[model samples]
Target: MATSPGSDIAFASQKSMPSENLRTKKLPLSEEEVFYMNCRAVYLTVFKSSLENIISKDQLYLALQHAGRNPSQKTIDKYWTPQTAKLNFDDFCVILRKEKPTSKAELLKSFKQLDVNDDGYILHTDLYKFLTKRGEKMTPEEVNTIINLPNINADGKFDYIKFCKLYMTTSGQCLKTALERLQVDSKQRRQQFGSHMEELPARDPSSVLKPSPRILRNSDQETLSNRGDPRASLLSTARKFKASVTCTISMAANGNQNAKLTEPNLKDWPGVQSRGCFFLEDDGETVSHQYRLHMAQRSTVHLTIKPLNLSQVEGKLSPWSSVDTALYILKENEDQVDPQLVCFTDLQHREGFGWTGELTPGLYRLLPSTSGCRLRKERTPEPEEAQLVCRDDAGDLFLTQAFKAALSDVFDVIDLDGNGFLSLEEYNFFELRTSGEKCGEEAWLLCREHFDTKKNELTRQGFMDLHLMEANDREGDPCDLWVTLRAMGYNRALELKEACPFVIDLHAERCKPRLKAVRMEASRGQLEKATCQSVLLQGEARAMDGYENVLVHTRSWDFRITSVIENKSDNKVIIHINNELSKNCVNNRGLNVFAVEVAPQSSMVCQHVMPLNEHQEWVHHCVYSLISS
Candidate 1:
């Protein structure tokens, strides 16, 4: 008899089935492959070939229970709810293939792959394609902006160096990259324009990018005068005394107390154009005044004083009243003399009697309106209290200079043996005394491993190296522990109960599950029956085991699950729903499908009858529709 093709195929399969099974048994599946197979089986069993299959809460619960996989409600909501609780072929592939570059080298490799042209740069189009493949939906404008970042080349291309710098750091916002590029550009501009702007005013050292104010010169005065401005006269007069002056003055207020005076001069005064003038008066109402007033150069005048009796005056003299003195500056091309009020004062009161105004640099004369009036240059007492206050303020100088000096002091104190070296025991003692905390066993071990030798315990250099290494690992302060303690002051160090509060040890071991557990009670009956037009079912199935325990809420149809039965042989589940309301508009009996209609005011119970997997799929659809609504 001749064998058909189908029959031949079947006979061959039967003959090779045992060998295939043996081979399969010998080669165990990998964990990832096994997981994929399980997921595929669950998907096929629940959805079959239907494109619009939905997994309801109860159905999903049963499926998960059968598969022996339980996931939290939060996980389910995060991954499933946003997709309407349905898994399409694309979504299934996404869940299985989701991954990201784990290292800088891997990211750079991927970036190079995106450079399709074999050039050293990535263009805008390539970047857009790369981001799109990674499931990032970006607009053309956004892609252009990213590709045209300041760090990128002018031709809108990304180089490997800049790309690596941008992604290698934890802060990937590209701010640092932009700032670096900005600094480079600024330097380039400065170099290019430095020669052309050589005449620009120099910047002050104390401030950044600020030019010092220009001093007015004789040339400036000439320039202003050529412009026919009134300020030219003032400027000319102000600049004439910019040279040195030689003048002296003395004051004898009571004839018995005479005070010598410093030479009134403009030699040391760079911007000053005027100085105070002084005179002396006697108690017998006699006045004597002297002034070295000149228009071109310095001059001196000495006057002899004659005493006047105030009782001989025509009008009665009040004891508290004093004569008014005035000084005036002679103005050029004018008959009137401008009062140099600011330069005049009574010797007794040490203040102007009538007027006080600024006296510009010019010719001036001192005159007294009545007797017993003279200018006085009072001998100001030394400010010893002020000097003491300043000395107290100088105490803060330690804050600026104490870092190095205090470090030296601490090092000497810590070197108890005075051998210029610190043993492990000595270092520990110093640490305990300074910070109130002992070094860890691992720290000591690490120090020994790196720096310990047969002869030397730890030299100064070796100790510094070990300390720096530890500080770097723990992100601690780089300053010496003893030095930091001394800088903080003894009183402040005593106030701190714990040691090294500022140092954070990132490598220290911590308990499992670093995040704290938060208790979240499921919300029940939050939505009223009248307000709820649909039902919401949530929670885990494997959490409930093979039982039908679930959180169910309903609104329009006042229904509840009365009982649930599962058939293990056929993999079928039966859910019986009971209506709470006595009067109902729809027939509520035996629902073999997800949705059903019933006669109004009829039976108060309903049954959803379907295969176990099919029932779960139908419930998924119902839940999805409810959520979407």
Candidate 2:
């Protein structure tokens, strides 16, 4: 999002925080607590494991993959399988309390065991069988959580070596802190058998993996038919079927149909902001074509990683992302980023990871990143259609010759003073027409930073760079740029669209405004070079016996006339104004010709000056007369 034709900046806290106890410092968890944390740290890694408040051996296996540390199945069997009971979340708290932190050599050896073919890759089937068939079986959902999308390729192989290398870089303390952030106290496990309740709402008991689906007998069916089973097992019971808690990650916008708009985050992150997904598009993190959602006012972004075949994700060298990628939300302004409100949703989320509170109105990019950190772009080819339009070559930015030529002509049109640089006023004039927006001073400065500029005015190169920046932010989506192109009169073929050559606007209260386009005595051509320049009260008013010539002049650009019309006729009179000469400059809902009817002996004023398009500017002299109604 290197500024979506917009900007960035991290946030500074605006609100004064209420004072708290100064002397007390929070202590870190030790032993089993830390181990339990390391297990739960696999939140997104184990698919919906966060919500259940408990984990299975299958879950532990996925967590181990994430930590790049795997223990022997014997260790698992001795410490875990002895209890033929549902595994509660608290059961693993001390699984490692007595043992030292697993060593790097042990972790490496653990990974080596799974590479049966010694091919330097861990196959998905090898892991799926190892975790499910032995120790505690994990649901396929859990296994898929760790092995899906950006992590594993279509052929189902994991680069365990690369993952292990990244693991080695982090120190023991950093790893411990990352793991224990959420496991501060004893987990509020499910209230068992009506024991002294803690006055908190109860959730469904965490599903325990069944060895196999229990087949129902005829007697069992008859008994069920007599009394319908209201509650059915929600965990995987058979080899192919799973019925865990509802998958909230896949919920559509309808999930938040009553999404009320709020501005909570605005107080924390104030200043010039953008208005779309907050991703650094220049960083090569592009969304799938269909997923580039724009919210005019409000929208719920469904951020699922596109399959490798659909879109190439360059996370092979990214350790954390390839192992446990997440979609991070960050607030951006003027090239500064403030993770004002930060949260991570699993790249393979199933625990309903979503905006827990009101997502304040502003630009927020959901980056599929190694912790939502902006990285240098290692981009793939942009969207096919956009590149086709621009036809970029390697390192050429692919800006097509046609598009560049069109932009050059556009710069000349908007430059206004023949200085070869577009001033703020001139640029805003272009901006207002093409995008219906004004590029603010800060935005202009950003333009300077990214592109070529002189004396603060955007140069021709800067203008081109600005468009390229927009295209990059959109991940090669062509709609936005095309809007500007078409507005500037570029057609699909990049040819200038046909336009009406002359335009005039005026309103007179006591005078009927009449306009006409007279051919130039020389080689039929436009008169001058000023763009959208309008000088007010720049006209002469004269009275004649039969009619009046209320004249206004075009100063080489778009102009308007404002005057009053008076009627002293005994009967009603009709005066008509025609803008046929200025049709191209009229916005939608503006008419070419309008009549003003005045009552007997009364005067009528034109309601508004002629409405015209700023896209093409002009000024014209006016003459008026009356007709009997």
Q: Residues 234-322, candidate 1, lDDT per residue (tens digit)? A: 12211111111111112122221222122233233222111111112111112222122333322222111111112324766422222
Each prediction's RMSD over C-alphas, in Å, is: 46.3, 31.2
Itemize residue pairs with steric clashes in candidate 1.
Answer: 55-620, 56-619, 56-620, 59-616, 587-598, 587-599, 591-607
On TM-score, the candidate that comes out on top is 2
- lDDT, model 1: 0.29
For model 2 the local lDDT of residue 550 reads 20
lDDT of 2 at 60: 52
lDDT of 2 by residue, 1-629 (tens): 12553456211111122124223554654442344445455332333334453346665533433343334443344444544343333333333322234444655566776778887688878767765666545666655544542322348786665544323432232244334433332343222211112222333445321221111111222221101110010011111111111100111211232432222233332222111111122212222110111223332233323111101245342111211122344444556533232333422222112223323334543333221112223234433232224434563345677677767766765554446788887776566555545667776766677678899888888788777776666667666666666455444666442211111111222222222111111110110100101112232233322333221222111122233344454654434343433432331113333434455554433322322332333332222323222
lDDT of each: 0.29, 0.37
Model 2: CA > 4 A from native: 1-388, 391-397, 497-566, 570-572, 575-629
Q: What is the lDDT of residue 258 in candidate 1?
A: 24
lDDT at position 120, candidate 2: 64
